[model samples]
Target: MNTLSPTTAAQAPPSRWALASLSLSMLLPSLDTSIANAGLPALAGTFEASFAQVQWIVLAYLLSITTLLVSAGRLGDLMGRRRLLLCGISLFTLASLLCGLAPSLGWLIAARALQGLGAAIMLALTLALVGETVPKARIGSAMGLLGSLSAIGTTLGPALGGVLLVASGWQAIFLVSVPLGLLNSWLAWRYLPADGPFAKGKPRGFDLPGSLVLALTLGAYALAMTQGHWVLLLLAAAGAGLFVWRQGRVAVPLVRLQLLGDRQLSAGLAMSLLVSTVIMSTLVVGPFYLARGLGLDALAVGLVLAAGPAVAALSGVPAGRLVDRWGTRRMTQAGLLGMALGGTLLALLPSASAVPGYLMPMLLLTASYALFQAANNTSIMAGIDPQQRGVVAGLLSLSRNLGLISGAACMGALFAFATAADVSIASAPALAQGLHASFAVATVLIILALLISHFALGKRGQSGTPD
Candidate 1:
């Protein structure tokens, strides 16, 4: 297949303004993920719905993104990234407006799903554009900036959503995105480079069958994770089998199976899954520890929790620079080592050490995560074939999302098991024991990630090449 070469520093780096537009695109979707979660109770009250029904407001958005992300990326590859991204932004804005105006629970859920579709496109295309716009030498920095903004958006969501919900009602939570979406669209159109013309031939057709099967599979898997249904897990497994079978026979598969054979790419995806799972443990386990073990109030717990993302936001750009200077391989290992140390500290430190003890490890873990994410992403994108950048970026996002889901389930379960009592009634000592056990498991996971990085990336020097 004929394609334009990937953008490189030699071809002139894109302006900082262009990078800002892409950064905004990254921020919007990450914000939406947690923003609505804060408004779930308000939405339940407004719609007079049960908690289960209201939960769909958040689940719909997540399901839509998880199911459609890869397809959205491939569509961008076929239809043109720039064109599709504008459409995505427009759809997101319109959907956000609809969500704010929704009169019933069903309407809000549908609108959230639509918003998720747009978000999937934006999330996938923004990274793809970096490969198309940023110079290779500076890719880590760009990745870092985008990663920082994403962390900020996610961290800012609950606080921002709570303030908006209290002052303006639940509608404000969804409505806020409208103005940001409009601004993002304008900036993207004005600053983003135009797409080169497609190579002439019979245009490549989308893999409808494969997309449908994969979507169903992912939907089932996500449901299985969230709802803890063995039946859904089985269904997901069956769907996966069907997807693999269909991909092998299809004329144009959504995901080329051969791509998975690349040890570097596979390892990158695996490491992302493991690291994200470990990072998510902080979110899943920390709240209980702060409230129970540390005997903090709700407000204090939130304040303590915010420290992690705050560290992530602060360290993103500097971490990216380190990756650029030290090389992806070295920085990747360094980040993992830092994370392992943090996890070990969290496990070993006594609750008597108090807030500072928790914050210390939490901060280190979050900062190292920013470094690892920027370095790992740069390593993956730097060596990718240009034509596959979109789908690959989508895969990276998907792996992270899956890890979060896994962490929520697995880590939460681990904590409960360690407590050996009903979580709500667990004592401070029990909670502390749970925290220690959870971080011990998290440290193990990080060590495993380190092993993967060491073996797959090899003892290479500055360049991220395996010897």
Candidate 2:
């Protein structure tokens, strides 16, 4: 596939209708990621599965998407963002239907993996297309809106899932996506632009070997985390080494290794990974603390938990304007500092309190994340050439996915290990102790992210170059 040069004339800004379609398309996958968590208990009861087995329902989807993101992005660059998005929406819709109809846990998990593949495709292209379609001056605002909607979808998942579960069943959560996906696909087909020319004359065929090795690397890492198998770590390392070696040698690499050399882009990616780890860890553990330690019901927990993302959604557009005016570095620094404070608050708060203690910290953390996401995303996308946006978008998505998987696995492990005596029973006190430890760790991670952003992202008040 050929692509237009980076300096080519800017395309017309996407109309509100097109942007709405894209935003809705993005929301589906984001919502799907967390919605199932609200119904995990119901699902476990239905299948008579162990806690570990039921976890795969979420893990399978995350792992599949995490493994395939970079490859999917490259595919979008080669094929066409609009075309790939259409296919993704179709597949995701079908998979959601299958998940809703699945008669067994195994079947639902399998369908979820398919859903992940579709999500990877859609996510990889959404940002690239948005960047390409919108004017450079407005990219920050567009990214902010997109990021805001995605966060809203994720934050709303549990609450929405609760309503569906109460009204119909767990199946309703999956079934809900089917109609949304269809509508999104139709809007995309009607409004989205066609693919651009490739950089080369002939298509550089997909780098199958590199993609396989990359997938193996991530799969091994995730398996090791979930299964507590040390050998898989070595396999993952080997695959990473091979993947890096292949990218340097291959004509059409899955990712261009040189992209990592860009300080801004690299820093943005690193920050995204760490921030996502903290956010996802909070999302995974916060509800447990609320429901189990504080003894709140699902609805109460959902309301309390929604504070962060709600704050994030509200702040997103404003954050984008700040990024445009004050620059990515300053906004990102402020955001990271806010996250650090939020994490610190969580670590110190008495887990017995559910209202102000829990909700305040979450609001701070999530609002900071909103600022960071909009600024950091604009920075990363701006640092790269337009033609390479697809690949970089995939990389960005890869970082977030891996961070999510790591957060869930690592925090779960830490909680279990810290509460070894009460592992089976999971007494409230023990759970509280584990949550404190997890939050402490997250705080430290955020500080480290802050330092990285400071040193690597350059001086404050430096606006990123627009796409």
Residue 419 of model 1 has an lDDT of: 87
lDDT of 1 by residue, 286-356 (tens): 99888888889999998899989998998999998888788888999999999999999999979789999
Q: Assess each prediction's global lDDT (C-alpha) against the native.
A: 0.88, 0.83
Give the runs in model 2 whose Cα sits over 4 Å from its true position. 1-13, 40-54, 103-106, 200-203, 291-299, 350-354, 415-436, 464-467
TM-score for candidate 2, please give it.
0.89
Number of the top-ranking candidate, with TM-score as the measure: 1
* True lDDT of residue 122, candidate 2: 86
Among residues 3 or more apart in sequence or in different chains, the pairs in candidate 1 whose N, CA or C atoms overlap within 3 Å are: 9-135
Model 1: weakest 10-residue lDDT segment is: 1-10
Candidate 2 per-residue lDDT over residues 1-467, each given as its tens digit: 11233543344334676687789878999999889998999999999998889999988888888888888888887887788889998999999999999999999999999999999888888887776566567767888898998888887887799899999999998999999999998888877766666657745678999999999999999888767888998999999999999999999787888889988888888989998888888877777778877888978987777777788988988888778877778888888999999989888888556578878888889888888898888888765776677789999988887787778788777767765545446878887787888889999999999999878866734765333
